[model samples]
Target: MSQSPTLEEELERARDLSVSDLADAIESIGFECTRCGACCTGHGPEADREPHTATVFPDEVRELQAATADHAGDETGDAGDETDGAGRDEDAPADASTEWRDVARPMPYGLTDGDDGPEGETFEWALQTDACGDCVFYEETETDGETTGACSVHADRPLICETYPFSVALDGTSQPMGEAVDSVTLPARGDADEAGDAAETVRAHECEGLGRDISRADAEELAAALKERAVRELTEAVGVRDTYEPARPGPGEVVVHDSEGAKRPDGTSVDD
Candidate 1:
């Protein structure tokens, strides 16, 4: 099996990128989100959105939980100490201890086979989804019966969402995923005093805002965000690895670990 990249390596690769470098790289290939919400809705056995997966880091899970908790608090603040359910936040479950569970869930696949944590089961946490199988953070609004998708917590969305259709390579270069189209054309070398380096040549297909022009300011803004995301991800990943414990499963059984310890089939925690 291939080995994972070390945190130091990841950080080095991401940090080496300067704001100017990335700005120049993606300026011509600029992306303006059409907000069609195509990325947010495809998660199940559909042909167009098949094999959809949104990998959220641990801190992202915490941020989303906090967002819901804060929203819940606001909901009940007028009640004067009256709790939502058992005195927890209101946007989600009233169970203070397990409210985070309602906000995020384990990704399907191997994760679904585990016992339900509400009974004492423990498992890895992933982004929660609604009945339609879209991301929980996604909200649908209808005007004149035209439905539009919006993020309930747009400012606090996960890094991947912010860098949609674009990801940093191990080479520290930015490249757009081939799934999107409608991109801004970069300037020719003689067009500007110092034409920024050429943009990546990615296959295009769907985005409506693909051909729009983007200012240097917008590219710089994206660069700052991408840098921050890369750093934070590596930092958090390092922390997780430093404290991780290998699972010691029974001969014929698998195990799930949580902060409290190994969980029971009923969602209760027991000593490790």
Candidate 2:
């Protein structure tokens, strides 16, 4: 059997990818977010009611924490009495102590959902989810009697979120990780049928906006981000492999493995 490519090999492949070529592929298969929130919520008809899980880097988690704290501070700036006319403190200060748990949780991939909670060692972090299994940062706004879904932390969202529905076919890196509920297969590259080779390296997952017309500038921008994501993912995989160490946790306890090393679900160092 063929052995899987090493992380370093994958990283090299990622670096060698041509951003211009990726842009051409993206332009060939266009996309534009319809803001349907299907990607952020579990309840969409095409979602299969599964929680949205996007890999987030440790630095991205910290960035999200900072963003949330700043937003809380803005909402609580000195404006007047905290109480409303009804004498209720409806405008009380928002919790500014945004912890790691507030922004992300251990990705559930290698964990087991026990009676107490998820138990086992997982890799990386995922954005927090609401009780409804929707992204915690996902919100809906009603304007002109039309409701549109939006992300509260869109500016600080993780790379996976930024490059949704688009993933590079590279080893040691799986963006849009799970089996896509729906996807668009691009045309064969060169003479794929004659050569028995796979199609293009760019894969487009489920999105209502797929097949729409995309401007050259937008396609190029997306391609750049996609390339960055591919490189980062492979780099992170190498880090994880180099730093990985076995851990033992009691029942109901969960450990997470990331590029930084092992950590508890709360983002605390495992040694702590």
Q: Whose TM-score is greatest here?
A: 2
Q: How would you encode candidate 1's per-residue C-alpha lDDT over 87-158 as one tens digit per residue?
A: 454454435532555555543435323352322222434466666667777877888988878888788887
lDDT of 1: 0.55
Write model 2 residue lDDT over 25-44, tens digit each, in one string.
88888888889887887654
Candidate 1 lDDT at 208 equals: 59
Model 2 pairs whose backbones collide: none
RMSD of 1: 7.6
TM-score of 1: 0.64
Task: Give all TM-scores, in the order shown.
Answer: 0.64, 0.84
